[model samples]
Target: MATKEFKLPDVGEGVAEGELVNWLVSPGDTVTEDQPVAEVETDKALVEVPSPYDGTVKELLAEEGEMVPVGDVIITFEVGEEAPEGGSEEAEAGTEAEAEAESESEAAPAEESAESAESAESAESAAPAPGSGRVFAPPSARRLARELGVDIGAVQGSGQSGRITEADVREHAESGGGEASESAGPKDVEVGTRPSATTKRGEESASAAAGGAEEGGAAPSGVEAAGRDRTLAAPATRRVAEEEGVDVDDVPTDELREGEAFVDEAQVRQYADAVKRAKAAEAEAATEAEPSGAEPSAAESGAESGAAAESGAEPETIPYRGVRRTIGEQMQQSKYTAPHVTHHDTATIDDLVETRTELKERAAERDVKLTYLPFVLKAVVAALKEHRHLNSELREDDDEIVLKSEYNVGIAVATDAGLMVPVVDDVDQKGLLEIAAEVNDLASRARDRSLSREEMQGGTFTVTNFGAVGGEYATPIINYPETAILGLGAIEKRPAVKEVDDGGFMDDDGPSEQVVPAHTLPLSLSIDHRVVDGADAARFTNRVIELLENPQLLLLE
Candidate 1:
């Protein structure tokens, strides 16, 4: 076998590098060709990198959270005689002679190891006993296990091909599946945990620092030790213990399930409470012992308050990287680079609302979610056609403002990880129903972090809906390179001046103006003032409002 170095390939859009988010395979794990070996976070998405060789993972060269450039070796694989693509031929030169020498050496031990090999093979074929073997689970499932503080390896897989799923992790956590035995000296799994680490398929370390227990072999340092070789606790549980100044390895628990102990959130909380109470009591006793009538010295009181405040207010450090970091960099670039101006207006849509109500049933029948967004999108596209500058880019290098001919619209989606803008390509060429369906799919996939590179890029204009989360308006920054963006506010019934015939009693000039409640949609359109003028922004916004008010104009598109 020869060792081969696997380089990071361009995920998409000619990306130069990627942030190594997680390693799907570890050293010594067997993998097949095209199997995902690591997850790389590009500028746009978190993508899984597949293996090019079928072999055993010899080493993982890149660390998680490290930024690796394209064509840089991230991992090594030991494969068959003719090493897989990109394998080192020089490394295989010594293999033939080495194999013969090894063959001569192994012949003597072959007979002696026959029985052991047979037993090992049989054990491999059967279901592995809990608390013992390598876990086969997806990365998402592992992450779930870490959050829930369950021992993934000990939990039985209920997925196809004996793989583990998020549901299995949750079930294992709830059922208190398995834990360390008390007889085992400070087992890796914590007491009270139902089962444990799978990961960023990242998992938590099982073993706690081992030491002498009490004389009676009870847990040491006021905490119940794990029964197994590793302590099992969720990352969240460990964090709580750290904040509370409690050691997770020493957390005491009375609950045991299936002859095992795994630490959980409840156990951590209980331990934290006890530690707090104990400190409070100690403080109170110290106060009482000070004096019967004497007050604490000002210096002493100040010191106590200062220490408590310092500890309580210690800020948690969150490493800003990956998608969130990318978003920050883009936002900063756009804000600092572009001169922005915003125009705010409202569209009264009573007729438009009725039209939507009438067509909603028809839309539902076709399994489409008819949202105000679809109508808004058509309106925006129509407006863009009239005002081409709004749907354009400022090419500073060329010293020109280039107006794009394509009508690709980017919809800003707020994901749990960060902000993502999934673009809808050729919006002018598609129907309203097609746009609606595509928007729904893009939004769903954006949240799931499953959108493709093509789906995330190539937007000429952008739209953001703050109304979904309840906001009136915002000065949205342009999706840099793009000239402008539109923000939508919640639709609310507001008093508006309307022309009504009051039997022409007031005057013969015209119908009298009356104040009436009408459903009004607020809009905020922001543009790059370097290229787009304030008047241009107002004109584009007014065009959108006009289409939205008529809504019939949207159907004509």
Candidate 2:
């Protein structure tokens, strides 16, 4: 029986890693294709990972509560010698990926990496160096590389798609960077951690095998130290490099991995610093024959700009991974992409208080725990119908504004893990009680971290009641994609002008106003200014306030 290692597959919704909540199967247990083998809790929700092949479990690679990145191997199984009958397509894909990887590896030995988990060990000894094929390592591995002063590019990946783990870096450094670094040529190729690319300009290859590959017989291997127009880096790293005006393809390092480079933000920053320092130092040396006392030295100025020269205090640390990290990234995206404007207003809700008071008795009889949210949800939907732009998405890609006919509102719920927005679909079609029940259930599940991704998706607009935690008039960020968000403040009794007559009527004949204590609800509406005008926002808020002030009008709909 051949052993098959199962790497954690991408679970969907752009989730890259997950916390292994629990393992359903143990070693020596039987599992089949499509059988639930483990439960992984991603940044979104808890998910059951199913096995892809029929096999008896030989080993469990991960422990409970351990965080595993995507494409990292988490389990091993003993399976039949050949691919199962139903999984030929999967087997073929794996074979094709391996062939492609081998072709790439043969062309460039410094960039040894595996495309799939299978290629990670498939007779890889022939071309195996000391780096990862994917170069898709954890932050810890990259940190280790920096600390050890190792050129991560010169280190070969041995993980899924040639992932370089922390252990890989340590092993490579201890073994003096093994064969890959030795053949990496003149540029500080000995590995471990060599700072400054010019440290080892003319090093020799370890074996005649590498020397023979060159027609010159004994020429340095630095000619092709660069990859064949290919590099591995995370999306965020790429973005950082782009913003910093660094060409990701041109970033240089002293060492080479499987003949390729695994670039990170730190490396990109280092490359930028090195280039600036070199240029500045060259210019200064050419211009000034002696040290000038007026300005600082070029090397000192370069070091000032580089973060490597700074020091900081040690503090209690927490791993900014999983859901919190995901939430932060999304919030950052929304904040940066949209220009937000908030309009705040207050509505006298004395009638709303009386209506809810009366409805409370009826709702109690029906065994429903009624709240103001249902009414607010209904009012917002009604207001959205009049102003379609309020319930829309800005499709920047298509260069169009999509006004959605469906009124699905997402209620932001704060949970212990992170913030969750559970959407209530078709609010226009559902009654107040139906909407209330759905909201209650959604909130209950959201707090418990049981809401599925579907339940949290497809929102045209969002409602956040910050008043529950005691806040008035907040400018909330837009939910993104969605053009607007409605923020509700605390409902309190405040002194307000009340219109009255001799007959004790409100907003009636006499048209006279008097001071009185009235229940008031503050509304804060935040909109994407790019898609909406200030006047449009005011009209929407006025309509919602009007409906809330006269709660009986809800029955007319």
Best by TM-score: 1
Candidate 2 per-residue lDDT, tens place, 24-132, comes to: 5678877645444665666665555656667889999998668898778888888887645445446534533442232222111111111211232222223334333
Worst lDDT 10-window in candidate 1: 104-113
Per model, how many backbone clashes are there?
Answer: 34, 29
lDDT for each residue of candidate 1 in 314-357, tens digit (9 for 90 to 100)? 56565576567889999999999998888899889888788878
Q: What is the lDDT of residue 410 in candidate 1?
A: 96
Candidate 1 similarity to native, TM-score? 0.61
- Give Cα-based local distance difference scores for all models: 0.65, 0.65
